[model samples]
Every structure is written in structure tokens, then in C-alpha cells.
Target: MRRVLAELALGVRLAFAGGRRGWLRTAMATLGVGIGAAGLLLAASVPTMLDGRQARTDARYDSPGGVTVPAGRTTILAGPDGQSGDNAIRARLLWPEAPGAPLPPGVPAFPGDHQMYVSPALRAALDGPDGDTLRRQMPYEIVGTIAPAGLSGPHEYAYYAGYQRATALVEQQVAWRVDRFGYPSLDVEAGAGGTYVIVAVLVATLLLPVAIFIGAALRFGGDSRDRRLAAIRLIGADSRAVLRMAIGESLVPAGLGLLLGLLFYLLIRGQVERFWLFDVSVYSADVRPVPSLAVLAVAVILGLSAGVTLLGFRGVTVEPLGVLRQAPTWRGRLWWRLIAPAASLLLLYPVLLGRENVGEARTGIGAVLLIVALIPLLPYVVPVVARLLPDGTASWQLASQQLRRNPSSSTRAVSGIVVAVAGAIALQSLFGAAEVERSIPYDKADPAFLLQARDRTSTDAMKQRSARFEQVSGVRAGTVALYTIYQKDIIGLANLYIGDCRSLSQLATLTGGCEPGDTFTAGSAEKVITIDKGEINPAPGVRLAVPAKARKATLIGSNAQGVASAVLMTTIPAQLARVEPGFVETRMFTDEKPAVVAGKLRGVAAEIDPLAMFTAMAPEGDRFGPLRVALNVGSTLILLMMAVGLLLDVAARLHERRRILGVLAAVGARDGTVIWSVLLQVIVPVAAGLSLAVGAGTGIGALLMRLSQVPVIFTAGTVLLPVAAGAGLVLITTVAVLLPAVRRVTRTEELRYE
Candidate 1:
């Protein structure tokens, strides 16, 4: 034990002494590890940050004790014409049953009768700089605002009315049992299977780059350290001692890097908090690493550094005379290189082809394995690409020769780039796939605006208000539809037109023309009027029955302008329809912008819920935006680490080739020849790795898109960005790092020393 402690002390002393002599190299090495560690920390902290945000959301939305509505006693507001809006506001009465009773964390207690507190978003809509027109329509006392935590989505708008007023409105309308008393939450109803697959892909994207960076950092200063340890072995150290010494040496820089990483994380925590997920930035406090995770990250970084250092020692066998080197000198077999990636493809085929309904766990494992497979494949591709390069310029030939001669070293130098480029391509392709805009099923060529009422406002009242609103400038035309919930249907129904059949045909898209007094049913073919359920009475004691199966009917039509499972077009007065009291859906075609038109109409009703037609047509920005940002940032970091690793490896190789460079100079070789030779050494491997990466990345991206059922779009911009950026970085690094080192080594003075 004492002897082991002495060896550890000696190893640490040597590391410090080495750093003292060449602090720049030590600092660079530390910086590389530090960047890698920082990435690991950030990646690991994502779950914690999301968890904290969820906790905050739950705390804000969950109610402790409130007037819980009985299961079947809830009232849903529909349009006055017995039609239901697609997104109808639920009516809730918040009166202070106990004035002094405590409320949930974010819920505000009811103020007084006739006055109500609204959600922050609703308040902004009603009282913002442009909300004066809307404020006048409701005319309730502006008391307080509900926090975003109390609602489903941060942008969701909600209304609260005096208990008596809300109750009276419910009594007059179609009232179901109250669902709950707490604020509503924005529920994400996407398939859990798809979400899991996306999440798994995201995790792989983050972790793979981090692993490559750390691996590169561990191998930094490889050649010099190997020679130094070789000398120690010649002096009498055994293999165990040599391994311990290497671990100790690596531990110094790795320990410092861990500290630097922690500081880096702290510095970037604020910026991380600003990163959007689901179009919302989480609270700053939520973007923190958990204590246990922070500790674990440190331990993992340390263990990885030590483990890699010891593993490298396996190539060196210690003897009393010296160390015998068994480093890979010749390419053994090319077929082995295809094994991992080929297996990965086999595993992915089922998922990508949709042959298997594998859950998230299998999908995640497959994704991780696919990325891991790419790492080993890169090194083998180096030699294969070298063989393909035709003999050309002296620089090119020299570079290709070196790649063929010692493929492993060259492969190691650019391995990070391979991983980074491939990952970037895959992510960009995924983003492109995700960003493809979905065509709106509703009318896109026409100008339209939707207006919905709040509280217990009737369709007639909404119509009167809409009539006044149509008088505003920029209004081209307008129509009002009453929304209601029917007892027989699961969804709400709407009255498309209340006038003659001619007006109904003019108002809606119909397959068949109708005459005056002719009754028509409008809905999707799937929900067609059945013989038993088609007896819709347009007026008191007046019933109309259709003799067609609901599924096979041809008179049905679909409209996206408002929420309605089916539309009833009749000459009966809308007020006489057996619709439970509901809100009115007023749609207008206007020359004015939707926002402006909505603002103008807000003053026309107590609540105006504008349909998000444009928003609905847009791609899922909330899901794809944050993912793009994360992948880009992570890829950039990985590329930076690769550049550093390449530079380090080139510097080390140049040091090894100094004598040869000096000999060439002595034999009349020009500075340009030496510089070109050195540049090729780095360039050839980079070209080979990048080529493989691009091909593999594109294939992987296409496969993933197929799995997600998104069309693969290989745009020129997306394809060229990663390649150009990688090539540019390589060219710049070669000129900046290798050129200078080559010029220095080829000097006459350097030759004289040799």
C-alpha cells in the first residue's frame, strides 16, 4: 500500500513538473477535457431541468381544496344555434363560498360578486395596450390575474365570472357535470410511442458527441506520454506501476477539467435557462444540475480519464530492459469494420420499416447502438478511402501515403469530426423533416377570422355585436353560426345557415344544391346522419328524418373554420332549435390583418376566442425549434473539440517527424514541400472521415425520417452546410496549426541538431 502511494505521489509530481515546464500544452489539454466535461454536465442536467419545470407547473396548476364539481354536473358552453365550437371555453363560476378560505398556490380567491379574476393571458388579451375594444364588451371589474402555472399552456386564455352569473348562464344552456375546479392545463395528446422515439433520438444526439469529445481528450498527448512511460519502464517499473502512473498523470488534468467544467456550467446556466423547449423558456432555477448528478458527472469524468489512460497502456508491455510496443501497425482485416454498423442497420430496419411496434426502450437502444457503431467504422474507412485516392500532387500523394501507412493514428485524429459531421447531418435532416409545414385542411385562399363569445352570452347577442363589428373598416363580409352540444352525439353541433336553402348553399360548401324549405345535414361522411339518429327537428313539433346510413351519406361536408361535428341547414329560427344555451361562432372575411380584425371584434363580445388558423397551419415549431438549437450547439462543441484534437495529434506527429523533416531540408527539400507534406497528413484522414460521415449521416437521417413517417427532403442547403463547415474548419486548422510547426522543423538549425 505504501509503495502504491509513493508511486501515485511520484506520478502526480511528474505531471505537475511536466505542466510547469510546458504550461501551454497542459492548459490546452485541460481546456479540451473541460469542454467535454461541460458538455456532459449540460446533457446530464437536461432531465433535472425538465423535472424542475414540471414540478413548478404542477405546483402552480394543482388545487389543494376547492369546490369540486360533481362528475356529471359540468356545463359546457356551446354556440346558441345548437352547434359546438371546436375549442369551446368551459364555464366555471368562482364565487367566494368561504371568503377567507385559502386557495391553491397559483389560484386566486374569488374577489366579490359580478367581479372576476382572469388568467394572465386572458387579462392581456382583454386589457393589453390593444385590448381596450375587448375590455368594453365584458365590462367586469378588473381585479387580478391568474399565473401561467394555473393553466394548461402558458399562452392559453381563460375566463372567470361571478358565481351567480355563471350559474344562471349554465342553467339556461347545455350543462354537463363540472370536470374540475382548478385551472385547465394544456394537454399534449400526441402518440406516446412517437414522442418516445423522438426523445430517444434526441438523447442519442446529445450523448454521442459528448462521448467522442471525452475520448479524444483522454488520448491527448498520447505519443509523448507513451515515450515518457517507456523510459520509466526501462528504469525498472512493472506493468501495474506503469498503469498506475499513467492514471495518476491523467487524473491531474482531468480533476482540473472537472472543476473548470463545473464553473463553465455555472457560467452558462443563465443562457441554458433561456433555451426554449415547447416554445417556453423554463425558469432559471429549474435549469440546474441535481446534486447527486453533479457528483456522478465528476466521478464519471475522472473514471473515464483514468480508464482510458490505463487502457492505452495495454499496447505497451514492460520489461526490465525496456517496454515492448504492440501498437496496431498494419490493417488486419477490413470486413470487421462493417460488423457494428451492419448490425445497427439490421436492428433499425424493423423500426424504420414499421414492421415492429417496439416501445421506447428498444428504439432508444437501437438509436444508441447506431451512433456507437459509427465511431469504430470511421477508423476503418481511413485506409479504404486512401486506396481510392489517385496519385496526384506531391502533397496529395504524401498525405495519402501517410494515411495508408498508419491509419489508426490518422483515424484517431479525425474521429471526432466523423462523429460530429454525421450527427450534424442527421439532426439537420431531422429538423428539415420536422419543419415541413402541414397543409391546412381548411380554406387557405380566403381571408377569414373567427370570433367566439365568453360567459353566458347568447348567439342572438353575439349576432347583434357581430353586426356592429361588420360596420368597422376593412370588413368584407360576415356570418354567425350558433354552436351547441346534442345529447345523442359525443361532440357539439352547429347551425350552418338559418335562412332559406339558397342562403345555406351560398354560406357553406355543398355537394348538392338545395331549394327553399329543403332541410339538409352537413358533416363528414364518417359522421353522416343515420336513420335512427337523423331525426333533427328544426322547429317545434317539426321533424325531418333522413333514410341513409351515417357512413355512406354523400350530402355531408367538412369545414375547418369552426368547431362542429355536424351542421344543420334549415329555415327554422335558430332560437327555436333544441340547442342547450351556447356561445356564438362568428366568422368574417376581412381585408384587415387577422390580429387587427380580432382586436376590433374583441369589443363586440364579453369573450372573443380567435381561431388560430395561421398558427394551426404552421409546422410544430414548439417541438422542432428547441431540438434544432440543442443539436446545433452540441455539434458545434463537438467540432471544436475535434479541431483541437486534430491540432494536438498533428503537433505530436510533427514532433515525431522533426528528424525526417530536418533530413529533407538538409537534402534540399523546400519549405513548401515540408509544409504540404504535413498538411496532407491531417487533410487525407479528414477527407476520408468526412466522406464516410456524410454518406452514413444522410442514410441514417433518411432512415429516421422514414421511421417517423416524415418525408425525406435533401435540400442543397442542408446537405452542403455540414460538409462545407467541416472542410473549412479542417483547411483553416491545417494552415494555422500544421503549417507553422512544419516551417519551424524544416529550418537549417533544426537539421543541424538532427
Candidate 2:
């Protein structure tokens, strides 16, 4: 114990000395780790929080009496190819039956006869020249149920109404109020769910890898102190004592770092939480870490592990006599070539085979595999490439030869570069691919004018304008469809005006190029109107037994993501003839650019605005805001670290080979030659490393494309731009770190041993 304590004291002193000497480098490394840890924590925390909240919300729906929805409203979504010519469907608010029970689907059941529910079929025949059911034998699924007198009332005589009546209520609600235009809303009642373990797991996952990285960086200082360790060894301190000292060295600082990291995490937690895109408020209240107690313990263990491991390694392989005789050339097993390639291949194969559900696992596997393959191979490759450079001017030649002779030094030099290049290339690839997929084709379909109305006053004017506009332009007259929103009652429904039956055939082509006069056939007197996926009553592809007298309709199509907007595509005359006294009209289709007619529509309130309302589109120039900042900051720090590592290796080599470089200086080699040789050596290996990084980045993007629902395209700018930036960063970092060291060597006196 006494011996161990003494070693601990010595280690603590040495660790401080190292920190004091290398404060800048140490701080930079710590910052790098902190940022990475924070980012990871934030990412993990968001998804965890969202999933946790969703789970709790889902549990609330499993309560005793079951959930309650609006009364008389059945069928969650309209089916594709369903009955048309009736009124439109609207979204409704849900009310739960019991604490845990889900809200049933239907019209809101207020206890009173003051509200009237009417079928949409009542006005269908009056509105158009045709009306019919597309199908006759379709069953209805209950979407929502209503209980009278709220949850407190006793059972009373209750009546159920048809979809037509329900739709009428929905229309009234929208027509009487403006709330129908509000963004969709979702509310949940959470029960006594357990503490959020998901948050803990997420935060831990984010921090753990960072902790491991910190541990690794901490190991570097521990390794550097081995020379001092040998001194103690020579002074009759046993190998175990030296090991203890190393352990003590790493633990003390790592403990400090752990403390700092935790504090940083806490300090930024609030800001981080807001931007997390997930709700983790539950975790913030639940998870409370003990004041550095766990961190201290972990630090101590890591220190001991690192110290003992390195001590054991030295005991087995490092000879004191060899150290005393001359500085040792860095040694590594050459078999890493075989091991790295094989392991990399193995790691990559799984990623290729991984399914969508296992995506995160595949990413983890790929990252691990790449690290394993890259780190070991870098040392060997760096040296061979360095050696192959032309041996010229004295400084360059000295730098090159010095690098060639020191494998450990080269490894350090390239570490930061590898990390920086990898990140830059990766981000470049991802964003580039995303951009390609997102940019809409320039010649997209446009709406000439959209007319919005609060009631029937604008329908006739809209119909007249539709005809006059087509006649004046000498183009085929476009169909005039009516759209309305009713909000005068307890329920709300959006209505569409389905125009000429022929326009129905062009529905699929609306998103692209189509012949204008395709015909859509409806059975009997009803015109078959195909609704946009979002505008459909029920979900697409299901049959709906709408109350259209004897006719039935089936849902034929649907948009995958929800409604962009509600649309009605029917004849103007048909729509006008059936207009309700109170309804809103809106139009959204045209071939003419609204910008050209902006002056013409300035005085017209009913003129449809040509600009599509995009709720989430970013403005110009800021498209790369957060992503660019993150990518650049992360890349800069890592690449800079890598550059520093290289310089450190070069410095160490220069220090060890002072005699060799001095002899070369005496041999008449020019300073320029020396400089070139050194730069060339660095340039060669780095180039190879860069190539590998670029290749890996390209491959990762391709893999993402294969795995994602959206296509991930590879563009020249995405691939090349980041690579160029990486190369530039390498040049800058190398020059910044090495110039002083290089200059000092050139000016310093050559050593002579006679």
C-alpha cells in the first residue's frame, strides 16, 4: 500500500506537469470530446423522449370505459375510389370516455335537440346533372362514438345518425368558424407511467462513447509519461509500482474531465432540450446523477486499467537496456494489414445485409468496422508512403527521413487528419444527396388563380370567370371545381366542387404532364369524382358506404404523407346548382404563373394566390444553416487535432534524431531540399489517407440511399467540395503546427559526437 501510494503521488505530480506543458492541446482535445458528447446526447435524447411520450399517450387510450369520439361519425378515413357527389369530410376533436380509454369517433354529442344533423345526399341531386353510388355492398367501420351529458351523466335515450348527418354537422362547424383552417392538433392524456428509462438510456448512450474517447485521449498522456516511469523502475521501484503511478496519473485528470463534462452537459441541457426536436421534459425531472461519485469511480477504474495494461505491455516487450542505449524505433506487427482489411470487409458486409428496422444497428456496425480497419492500417501505410517521397533539400529530407523512421509519430500526425477528412466527406455526401432529392423539378404544375369564399356569393362569379378566362386565352376551358369549409355547427367539414366528369381521368396526371380531356365515368346520374389523396373522406384504397341514396363509392388512391390541402374537382354548373347557403369556396389549380397576373388580381379578394403555402420551407441562403455550422466546426476541431498529432510525432522524431539531422546539415544538403523531403513525405501518406476517407464517405452515402425511403444521390459538389475543404484544412493545420518546429530545427546547432 505504501509503495502504491508513493507511485500515486508521483503520477499525480507528473500528470499536472504534462497538463501545464500541453494545456492548449489538452483543452482542444477536451473541447472536441465535449462537443461530440453533447451532440450525441442531444440526438439520442430527442428520439428517446418522443418514443417515451408516445408510449405514455398510447397507454392512456387503454383505460376502462374506452375512448369516445364524435357521435354518428364512423369510418376513420375515406377509401380510394369511394362514392362522390356528396359533401366533404372534416377532422374532429376527440374526447375520452374514461381516464385510460380512447376517444370514440363520431359527431360531438352535446345533450340537446338544438343541433340538426342532415345527410349530404339531400342536396346531391339538386347540385349536379348526375348522382350515383359507385358501390352498394360496403361495410362501415366505427371511427368515433359519442356519449351524451359528458362522462358524469346517466344513460339516456341516445340515437345514432348516418355519415350524411355527421358530415352535415361537420360542414356547419367549419362554415360558422375560422378554426377549421387551423393546423391539425393532437392531444394526449398520460397516466401514471413509470420513470423514463428511455431518457436515461439515451443520455447514457450519448455520453458513453464520449467517455471512452476521453479515456483514450487520457491514455496518451499516460503513455507519454513512461520514460519517467522507467526512471522510477531503475530506482528499484517494481513494475507494479510504475503501473500504479501510471494509473494514478490518468485517473486524476480524467476525474476532472468527467466532472467538467457532466457540468457542461447540465449547463447546456436546457438549451439543448429546446432544440432536441423531442420532448424529454420527463427525463429531466426523473434522472438525477450523484455528484461526480460515479464519474470519480469510473475515472479511477480507467486509470488503473490503462496503467496496468501499458505496464504489463512494457514489462513483456520494453527492455530498459534498449531504451538506455538509443531511442527505440516505433514497432507494430505487420499482420495488421491482413487483420484490418478482413475485419473491415466483415464489418461492411453486415451493413449491406441489414434491413430498415435494424438501421441503427447497421450504422453502429459500420462505424466500428471502419475504425478497426483504419487505425491499424494507418501507421504502416503512413511510413511506406513517407519513405517513397523524393529525398531532396536538407529540412525536407530530414523531416521525411525522420517521419519514415518513426511509425508512432506518423500515426499521431495522421490521426486528426483522418477524423476531420472522414467527417467532412461524410456530411458532404449526406447533404448533397438530400439536396438532390429535395429540389423539385423547375417546370412543376402551377395554378393560375385560386378563389376563396366564405359563402355562396362567390360561386357564380368564380364560374363566370373560369369560362371567360379560358375563352379569352384561346386555351381549352379548364373545369371549374367548388371548394367550401363549413363551421357553423359543432362539427366541421371541408367540401369540394367536382366539375366535368372528363377531368376525373386527369387526376393522376395533375402531378405531371397529362392530356386535358380524359374522361371519368360514374354509374347512373352521379358524376364520379376522384379526390386527391389528402382530400379523400377516409384513407385511400378502401371502400366507403357513403349515404348517396342507392349508390356507393370506393376509395382508389391516397397520398402517403397527409393532406397538403383539400381539393374539389367537379363541374362549375354542377357545383353551383348544389351550393349550400353557407360555405367557403377555394380553388388550387392553374397553368398560368400567378406572378405574371399579380397586378391583375390586386383588387380581387377571391383571386387565388398563386404561391403554394409551404409551412416549413427555409428561406434562401440559410438552407445550410445548422448543418453547415455543425459540419464545419466538428471537422475543423478534429482535423486540427489530427494535424497537431502529426506535428507532435514529427517533433518527437526530431528530438530523438538530433544527431542524424545535424550530420545531414553538415553534409551540404540545401535547406529547401530538407523542407521538400519532409513536406513530400507528409503529403504522400496524407493523400492516401484522404483517398481512403473519400472512398469511405462515398460508400456510406450509397449505403444510406439503399437504406432510406428517399433516394440519396451522389453529386460532384457534395463529393468533391468537402474533400477539397479537408485537403485545405490539412494544409493549414500542418503549416500552422509545423512551421515553428521546422524553423527551430533549421536554425539550431548540429550536434557532434567525437
TM-score of each model, in listed order: 0.75, 0.60
Predicted candidate 2 versus true structure: per-residue lDDT over 588-702, tens digit per residue: 2333333322222322221232111111111112233344455555555555454554455455554555565555567665556655655665676677777776776566556
Residue range 179-272, candidate 1, lDDT tens digits: 3333454544344234555556656655666566566656665656676787787777888888778777787778888888878877887665
In order of listing, the candidates' clash counts read: 23, 88
Maximum-lDDT candidate: 1
RMSD of 2: 14.0
Segments of candidate 2 deviating more than 4 angstroms: 18-224, 278-317, 324-360, 387-404, 441-576, 579-629, 636-659, 747-754
